[model samples]
Target chain A: MTNLTAQTRHHLVTARVENKAGVLLRVAGLFSRRGYNIISLAVAPTDDPAFSRISIVVDVESNLLQQVIDQLDKLINVVAITELDPEEATQAELLLATLARSVEHDADLGVLIQSAGASIVEMTDQATTIQLVAEPTVLDDFEEKLRSYGISELQRTGAVALPRLVQL
Target chain B: MKLTGAQALIKSLEREGVEVLFGLPGGAILPVYDPIIDSSIRHILVRHEQGAGHAAEGYAQVTGRPGVAMVTSGPGATNIVTALADAYMDSVPIVVITGQVATTSIGTDAFQEVDTTGITASVTKHNWLITDANDISRIVAEAFHVATTGRPGPVLIDFPKDVANATIDYEEPGELELPGYRVASAPDERSVAAAVELIAAAERPVLYVGGGVIKADAAKELAHFVGLTGIPVTTTLMARGAYPDAEALHLGMPGMHGAFAAVTAIQRCDLLISFGARFDDRVTGRVEDFAKGAKVIHVDIDRAEIGKVRRPEVGIVADCRLAISALNEQIAKNSAAQSRDRIATWVERCLDWKQRFPFTYEGAGTAAPGDIGRIKPQFVVEELRRLTPPETILVAGVGQHQMWAAQHWGFVDPRSWVNSGGLGTMGFAVPAAIGAKVGCPSKMVWAVDGDGCFQMTAQELVTASSERIPVKIAILNNAYLGMVRQWQHMFYEQRYSEVYLSPDLPDYVKWAEAMGCVGLRVTDPKDVAAAIEQANAVNDRPVVVDFRTDSMEHVFPMVPAGASNDEILVHPSQADQPR
Candidate 1:
């Protein structure tokens, strides 16, 4: 009714392409060439695959966003394409780990982080590592709460999502 | 097949295409020097170890290759840490090789021995202490790979003396095995769509571009995005020349000491799209209030930068070039366009702000009756800009002169404008100029310095003259560290610290003359041009022009420390009477 396109919470796009040289160049080239920013991407080979499957998470309008899928399909090695919605399909998770400097020295801080769904992964004299997997906002809140405990270093892997149902 | 660790190091360097090294010779690193005699690698012996580090920075900046510098352990390595830090902060790719005391001497508090690895850990991207001869080739190869890859930065390899002398079968350099690190090239599409939506909806938008664009070579894509969106763009100090100043939408630098128009536009924007920029303190003054009215969208290659400061309304952790292109596609498909009148209104407001607070200097109103005929710093910058060709690389000593150069000079190429932007190190320009001249021998390199900064490492003039590097130095001799004194005068109630060096000036000029270089002193404003001309004429040897500038003149458009970007002390004009 507003005439403006309604924004979706998230989008999932799967691209199957050759795992050859500059395949990255072509894929990245397509996105950057179009001025698109991918939020989360999981790239790996499928079970029957001579080709690689690239799962891309992007927020875009339905019509123009379909063009990206078509473009990915046009790549010489690209075999197929599928766009998934988090609300309808299964969800994937992204893992983030941050090394905390003190644990026993800051007991309440450690308990507070665990409350945010982060588990103590590793502990050493210099630092303790806390691992978390959740929505981006939860990760943000977890990192923010742990800051008072002093974070020495941090690392996060690309988001990996799967369909909630096993059916293809 | 057996060779000394030092020999393997040299061989690995040769394979890496290293042609020159800048460093000082010391006891621990003598073995490396021995191999240098036979190798094709040329070593430029600097007067000081620190000069060697900055020289490497200069070489790295110009060549886009990893600059190599060699130094001995202990004081030698410590001396070069400031330069290493400068390279680190600026993201200059440099490979620093230092010699440690022999293996047996470890933890003995041996003479001339210090923990070079520990000393440089924070300053280097990656570093290793090679205790075994067998690990030499692998470590050297990995150092080069690490230094030149991803976001290029300085890497160090601390070679123990005994390890350098020890012999083993040398293996050829192999593929680098860095499993944890991979430079992100593709953008996440969801983030791109969100950014496009924000861009399409916003009435007043500003594109804040930073050095990451130049580093990733995404200038063309960035320009195209700006063109399509018709959004005004502002760069951080490091991102100068990414978008040409002559471009219609380019608003120059923003934040503390930035253009008044840029700061005002950023403050008034409805949305701020940050591309490849780390929101540094200097750029984002008091982060909480910065762009308070806008919905911030930050796009960078590094995920660590997303929520570091001033939480973004939409944070896209992807390469700017890729992200912008994706967003452009979405916008094109949707055909979502904002009203042209809104853009026009913002542009008119920006123009009005520029007119109100123009950056200018008016010669102290014909000079006071008893004025000592001091040269104005602005005149020095203007004269240098006039005399030099557009391609001339201007390197500056950190302080008032550096900021003045940044504000005044309109750089036309990426990497053409180089400075220790965040580090703000004094005594940087001379050696850096030499390195720049060495890297691009055909181009004219000018080392702009202040009297205070020039004296810090002015001894390198001897090295410059001896090497016949032909770096023309224009020293803005205000006889005081102008920036510090300005802060003291404005904020500290004029209680000047040890900033003056008047009576000691004669000794420095005499030293320059003694070092086989021509030294000219300019007191009157008219003599400034003639002195610069004379320095240009002496191309065979390095020339130093000492322009005695006014001690009281201050750099305007200053956002004092802890102040918001919107608040700036604009230069006093004719109507506004000076206190």
Candidate 2:
């Protein structure tokens, strides 16, 4: 087995691909065929709408890193490929956690949400829904905070990224 | 100009320089056939859709251009599955166009409404479903482009019946926008330097060649490098003719059933310079034990293939021609010729191995009068090699005969040998031979097939006969799935399950005659050459020579499946992989 900690790590890989039918399949196919471990993938229309931007967080082995980049770069549908470095990129993901109404302390959960930098989106007799938009790592920790509240359902968007702009 | 989708597609194929198309038409593809009848592209009507597909593969293997196949929907699409899979495995370029039900009737379960593109997606490099008539030309062009570029694989374009019937304004797509496909990659300078250093320093080095040499058309450059560097070359099955078999540096083959010396050289060599060849399981045997002593310098056009199997000391992802030529220049500049004397001892050792236990079978072409009933199949192959011209492009169906053809044929240049290498598909020879003959009309072509393989696609002879494609077929009639029987005999306690077909089955000669081919049967060893001569003389029609061979014989220098190349079992009793 490959060394999980050493070989697997989150890499922000963005691909600008033709906005056409089956383009997503092609990108997904490349990932599967090449055996790259994609932690998360998000595809959406770019600003121009002529092409789609596919942001994938891959657990890329250091040895297979160049190969992964080369393979992804060669797909005809993929117009451009960029692997955003952690030092140079900003990343974000959204999480929505629906907590069951059976929580022991609803007022305490509101205080916990305020302290954890989250907001209550909906509250009803059935459930209390909380939404958090933050860095992927922050959401991962926030999920642990919601665990004691007896969350019934949870949904999280895959990480989306862009290179950080600097005035310098 | 205004044109029907079928006309536009045909025009696009012609624009892409397609000379011939192999296909079987049906209701869905009838409109396309109408345009093909009048177009400059010659259409060869095949007996089965499978034949058309394999024939196209053969054509592409020899020409380096994508073979074109056009078949109707449903059964036609499914029939091509094997051929497409074969191309996918071997990286042969092919463009298969299958017709589909009309756009409205696609999901309505109308007659012949099969999801051709969906079914073929996994097997092909890419596939398209053309619902609009306007997309016909661009789709055809892109299909050809995608099929030929990158790793070179079969691509499919599904043409719905209504789309083919619809009229639209057609303009040829000026250029394809395939951002992912890479072509003609040059080797990295550092990697080349590393490879050159290894090649220069090694006293015992071997040059391993594979099908990519032919694919990249780098045989000439490779031969030049080997000649200048005095390196011994072992060509793999797919790369049989990439270097001259008669050359002094040649090491016939280097895997299971390969020459004892060639296999030994690989095992003992200090440096193995691999060019355009993957270390396939068949060649490497047990991967852990293969080339245990050699440090491999692997070069190929595909980057992912570099360390996919055996990790190389130096891996260069570049076109074989470009890499070899650059290496040639570097070697010439650096005076790498100084090491010729150092490699002399190694060359002599390889030569001694070749001279001592050459790939030869006992009683080959020299059977006694009493042994007339037992015609050696190897002898038949040797005789075929002797009788055929030097330029003969021999294609073989997979099995014992394919090995024999590879072992005995005198291949001197690239494209002179064509076979299903990676897939090892049976029933590939007949149609492939026809396709090859069609592609290289001036050259002699022969289909060396086994009885089992012949039975699967023998109907193709009718297509060959009808089209006047005069390729010869040599059926080594052992009355069994020869290789499977040999395996059962060698390892399965001789249980011989269902390997044998009844010897009293349909006569191949009569079957050949029924298909308008000149048929002959040679029972004795002495008659082998004469029968082949007769078959060769029948230039006006296709000929089938049924040579009944001894079923007891088995291919030697056997590595047994999954055994290391070095753990060779020359005879059946010494089976290497008993487990």
Candidate 3:
């Protein structure tokens, strides 16, 4: 059987858009209308209040990368688009997980959390909440390991990336 | 000066050189309509909002200016969505101003209120919803600028009721702050040189032209480029009038119902040079197999369109005129001695194909005097072509009559042919013809419509009559949705389902007369010319000539849906052979 997943590559594109109502929808609408698969999307205000930055990760072939960029550039609200190389760019994501807390597995959970570089943010008699900020791949591993403790709730901020600064 | 947002909208349009607009007013748009009476811009009140949108498109198509349309929120805004989509698909520059509910009541589901901006986001090239009265002038200016520039397309501006009623001190907007938007007009010399090299070395080359040529006003440049290169040109449906049909190099339109020579030329060419035309599915049937032997050279202003379909060997992102001019200069400078002798054999072969498989119907121009039942649609188109002047503008609605008009009308002038090429919107003829006549008052405009299509928006003729637009209408009455019926006849075991729109519903002649138009009916084949002449003579009012045509007749040289261009069905005899 052929694996459909093997044929596709993940692409990260960061775009600066006008900070205006309906602008985000305009950008998202282009992807949806064209039927481009958006794997993850993260949006927030930029340093300049007049503009917002949207980081989108899409599953597409290499041939369609330029088309994606070109289409995004066509939108009036989209100010600029930059494709960040996953290998060279600095990428990060945040994961928040609420897990059941019991005396029997408390020591094991504590050791697991410390080893995975995750910090317990809240503690209750019934449950414990942990937060982790790391590369998406690392968070995926940590989240998988946390599932053994019975994760009640989990939330993830999709990856945000920026090009690494070059040494002078 | 202190002015309401509505007043500023009118003043801004005047500043943008808008002389005419088409619209119908409703609740939310009342304030904007009030300013129209005092404005210098003449507004044509249409029966429906859809009619208003199409009329604007027709105006823009002929005048090479941004056409304007206005409507209220909710149903009114939704009604014009088809026209907006049509303009977007065809890249016709138009500005649509739709009124919305008061900003306070935007999300409350207020009366005559809908998310106009949200609904039109995908359809428009760009749109804006004004929250402040101070931003009206700048937004209006920006709307026009965005609509007309680069790859021209439709733009919509949604005006909330409260904003339109609010008064503010008007200040002329400063320089446009579209930092992201830029039009690349300068031709890249390296790409131009490469294209020229391809032309020189190519054994058989065909210039696949599209509507962008006319949109770019590059018809003259295109003519010069083809003449210099000695390349045969096959214009697309949207680009019918971009190249003169009488020119020796013109191979006619290439698409589903294209001429045999045009279809075959694209299929057979060793190199395909696309100028301002996207390789649309209608043009390149079964794209994988389309022009398998050809190396593509695509030049369009929109970079997104370059490799979106078939990847071009040499893709140049620049205006068609600038690119063509650059190519012409480089070719002239590089090879002054190279004559038409290089590609002479290939040209002769194409011309031979054109001569052998001419776009002709049986009994064309020579129908017997009393042969009333045998009148063909192609014959009527030919009669109109024969009777009208070369410069007369021809507009068509969707379906068989559209294909026939595209095939028969030897359009020699750019901007002389208008139709919904990409979207194939029916009932585009009457309103578009009215718009075309309004834009080009001195030029003759004739709308060639089909029976099924004519019934869709025939009420627009009333606007044409009341406004004294004086456009002519030729309804090819085939009594059925002819194109669909033809497909059913050929493909679906001859089971005609739901395609038969009755022959004599709402008697088109009486419908025309009721709209204050001179109605002429031609059942006899011999009266075709006289009827057309009579329609042409009525310059004071609109004229509708109902030409009863053969319902069984099919548009020939058709590339069946999703089939390769190589397997085109040229005639009925070829239809029997299994694919």
**Residue A86, candidate 3: alpha-carbon lDDT:** 77
**Predicted chain A of candidate 2: TM-score:** 0.90
Report iRMS values in order: 16.4, 2.8, 0.8
Q: lDDT per residue, candidate 1, B286-399, as tens digits?
A: 887788899999987766567656678898867667777777777667545434555777777766676565567766324331144667877777777778877888888898
Query: What lDDT does candidate 1 reach at residue B38?
Result: 98
Candidate 1 docking quality: incorrect, acceptable, medium or high: incorrect
Tell me, by TM-score, which candidate is best.
3
Q: Which residue ranges in model 2 land beyond 4 Å of their true spot? A: A1-13, A30-39, A57-74, A82-88, A102-105, A164-168, B365-373, B571-579
Question: Each candidate's DockQ score against the native complex?
Answer: 0.02, 0.43, 0.81
Score residue A20 of candidate 3 by CA lDDT: 89
| Docking class for candidate 3 | high
> Which residue pairs does candidate 3 place in steric collision?
none
Kindly give the stretch of ten consecutive residues in candidate 2 chain B with the minimal lDDT sum: B570-579
Off by over 4 Å in 3: A1-8, A102-104, B336-339, B365-373, B573-579
Chain B TM-score for the candidates in order: 0.94, 0.96, 0.97
Ranking by lDDT: 3, 2, 1
Residue-wise C-alpha lDDT for candidate 2, range B322-388, written one tens digit per residue? 8998888888876664368889999998988776656666564354532656778888888888888
Tens-digit lDDT track of model 3 for B451-568: 9999999999899889998999999998999999999998999999999887678698999999999998888887888899888889999999888888889999889999999988
The model with the greatest lDDT is 3
Instruction: Candidate 2: give its CA RMSD in angstroms.
Output: 3.2
